[model samples]
Target: TQLLEQSPQFLSIQEGENLTVYCNSSSVFSSLQWYRQEPGEGPVLLVTVVTGGEVKKLKRLTFQFGDARKDSSLHITAAQPGDTGLYLCAGSESYGNKLVFGAGTILRVKS
Candidate 1:
């Protein structure tokens, strides 16, 4: 399989809904980073999980890293038009400055 994979490349939902995006990998990673990117803008770091089975919450977003460090997920509690953007998950071998991004999940939250 591709080093990292994301499903449903696209997502659309009404406001006030919930959604989840996933990232999967076959190889283990030392650290995984999640970023949200908007059109014509660089991705902004949302969170990073170093240890396995780590969960971090930010506002309406919840991020989790798998026990093996090979996978991760992002869950949004309540959707909004402002939540529309591309969600990318990247994995690094040893906490290096490099990252391999997933296919990306394009979220479109309708009003």
Candidate 2:
């Protein structure tokens, strides 16, 4: 079984700060997804990357897939208190395959 490792399991920062979180795996994936979860709610899909070196942006958030498809990163710029939540990364080995999830990163943005 493959595992995705997320770094800096916890983070606490002031509002308007910029931060980056990472997810990495030894195995390549056909696609990778990023999600955010708030208290008492299920994770909401943020973005997905299928191509190597692909980058996507949503508002102040940026998502990137590594060249080998074995890693991914999420960066938040000028983060706001609303951004406080759990960030998760999931990868699938093939189309329609089961997804392997990383442990997750917890972020707290204080106003």
Candidate 3:
């Protein structure tokens, strides 16, 4: 089975701080998807990196896919209060159409 696990189940920091969240797995995946979800809302797609070693950036956020397609990372720069939310990493299995999500990393950025 392909499973993804994220580090630091919870993170709390003051505004303007920087942090990195990691997603690792023992099995390979065809693609990796990054999402951020706010309270009571569905997760919003942040980025989707398909190639190994691929990197994508959105605003103050950076995402990277592992060379073996078994891991990924998210880096946030100058975090703001609005950045506080649940961060999830999902990986698509070899045959399934559904994505298996990680335990999630809950982040809190206080002003």
What would the per-residue lDDT of candidate 2 be over residues 1-111, giving only the tens digit for each residue? 779999879999999999999999999999999999999999999999999999999999999999999999999999999999999999986656788999999999999
lDDT of 1 by residue, 1-111 (tens): 238898779999999999999999999988889999999999999999998999999999999999988889999988989999999998986654778889899999999
Task: Give candidate 1 regions above 4 Å deviation.
Answer: none
Q: Tens digit of lDDT per residue, candidate 3, span 4-99? A: 999989999999999999999999999999999999999999999999999999999999999999999999999999999999999998876889
Q: Which segments of candidate 3 are over 4 A away from where they belong?
A: none
Clash pairs for candidate 3: none
Clashes of 1: 0
Position 81, candidate 1: lDDT: 94
lDDT for model 3 comes to 0.96
When 1 and 2 are scored with lDDT, the better candidate is 2
For candidate 3, the 10 contiguous residues with the lowest summed lDDT are: 91-100
